[model samples]
Each structure stands twice: as structure tokens, then as C-alpha cells.
Target: MKRRFFCSTLFFITPLLILACNGPSDPGSNFSSGSVTPPLFAHSVKSLLTLSVIEPADPKRATALGQYLVWLVQIDRNGEPFPVNAISIDGGMPAHGHGLPTQPRVTAQVSEGRYRVEGLKFTMPGRWILNFTVSSKLGNDRFSLEIDVGH
Candidate 1:
């Protein structure tokens, strides 16, 4: 009975002894963090489109031409193109002007080499948030890019 108890205690204490002997300190202690940080603008456009622009006036009438311009987005990890999901441009001028479209969503597939976004119009010159949704084999992610066009 004593022999069996000793063997059981030895088995449980062996792993603990080994773990205590191999504490956390390592050779490369200078490294700040384990995970690598991706570039701000390189990996995504969450820092580009933030500024706002006023609507242009129409020739026939003084009515504002409330329309957002289209944008083409491209992502290159190492100078090579890759596929992305969809992009959304919200908040534009002329409160009563044509509202932004809902369906036939802006997709990357429409444009072969680049991701295309329609209805990127600005309502008034101020601050705006441009959100971009990128889908990859790994997963789908959202990024907010700020862009200033006019003053």
C-alpha cells in the first residue's frame, strides 16, 4: 500500500517540478509583444476617407446635385492584388437629395482588378466616416477610413 501511494505522489509531482524548473524567462526577452502589428493604411483604408465635400450646384436650377462619387479600392499585400468583400460610403449632402442606394451593393467582383464603391457622395463639407468591409478566406473584417476632400 505504501509503495502504491509513493508512486502516485511521484507521478503527480514530476510534472509540477519540471514546470517550475522551466519558468517563463526566455533568451529573447527584448521583444515587445508576440503578435505582429499590421500597417495602418497598407493593410486597410481605415485612415483615409474622413473629410466631407459640399454638393455641386446644377446649371438649370440652384438645387444641389446631391450625389456621391464612386471609388475604386485595391489591396496589395506584396505588390500582388487580392480579393476583398464590400465597401460602404454613408453620410452625404442635401438632406432632401436622393438617398443612398440599398441593394446591388458595392462589391469587388464588379471590378476585375479593383474593389468598386458607388454612392460615395458627400452632403456637406465636414467630417465623415468611410467604412470598408473586406472578406478573405480567413474571415470578414470591417475597417473605417477617414478622407478629407474639400476644406
Candidate 2:
């Protein structure tokens, strides 16, 4: 009976010890608690769609180097969740004239206007612009989110 109890205790404590030693699986999860700059407002005159980051609030400073999920929602001029037929996300450094290290793709439409983008990895620290093209029955609109990394 004692041997069985000891084995169970050891098994549970071993995993805890390993986790504590390694720390957070993704260190980038500790970035400053705030939304991206410019407040994620819409700029298009005709479409008037806005994109706001809902996860990793401060994308300017990532918590890890691997792929990360980017969550965003779109709103219309009336401040209501606006549904779009499709959305494409891409980014790059304007100065360097290059694109993002990873090709982020829209994985899902969480709701009417919310979206989840996966496979976004910033290999290096520099200025990055995330361009999003929103399309719907009405028309297609484009907007950009500017992120400054390693500053």
C-alpha cells in the first residue's frame, strides 16, 4: 500500500517539477498588457471596417519566436460586428521591402466579425505592417496594422 502511494506522489510531483523548471511554455505571453497602438480603428471611407487585436494585446513585443495566434474583430461605422465573406492577412517591413517570416492564415471566423489568424511568426525584431483585405457581398476593403518590434 505504501509503495503504491509513493509511486502516485512521485508521478504527480515529477511533472510539476519539470514544468516549474522550464517556466512558461511560451515566454512571449508576458508582453505589456495593452492593445496595439492607434487603437485599431477603421480608415476606409466606403467600407469603414475596423480591425482590433484581441489576443497578445501588445503585438509590438511578442512573447515567443514560434508561430502565434492573432485574434481580431471587425466593426462597422455603426460600431456593430460586421460579417465579411473572406479575409486575407499579410505583413512585411516597408523599409526592408520584405514580408513576414511566416505566412499567417485565417484559420476561422469565430463569429460575425471575429477572426483567428494562425502561423504568425516574427523571426526578427523590426517594423512590421499587417495588411488585411476584407471582402463581402458589398465590396472589398483593405486596412493595415503597424507593429514596431524590439523597440
Residue 39 lDDT in candidate 2:
45
Worst 10 residues of 1 by lDDT: 51-60
lDDT of 1: 0.45
TM-score of each: 0.43, 0.63
lDDT of 2 by residue, 16-93 (tens): 999787787757567775645444444553646666666656544332444464655554546777788887879788
Model 2 residue-pair collision total: 2
For model 2 the local lDDT of residue 81 reads 76
- As a whole number from 0 to 100, the lDDT of residue 30 in candidate 2 is 79
Q: Give Cα-based local distance difference scores for all models.
A: 0.45, 0.69
Off by over 4 Å in 2: 1-42, 45-47, 60-67
Instruction: Estimate the TM-score for candidate 2.
Output: 0.63
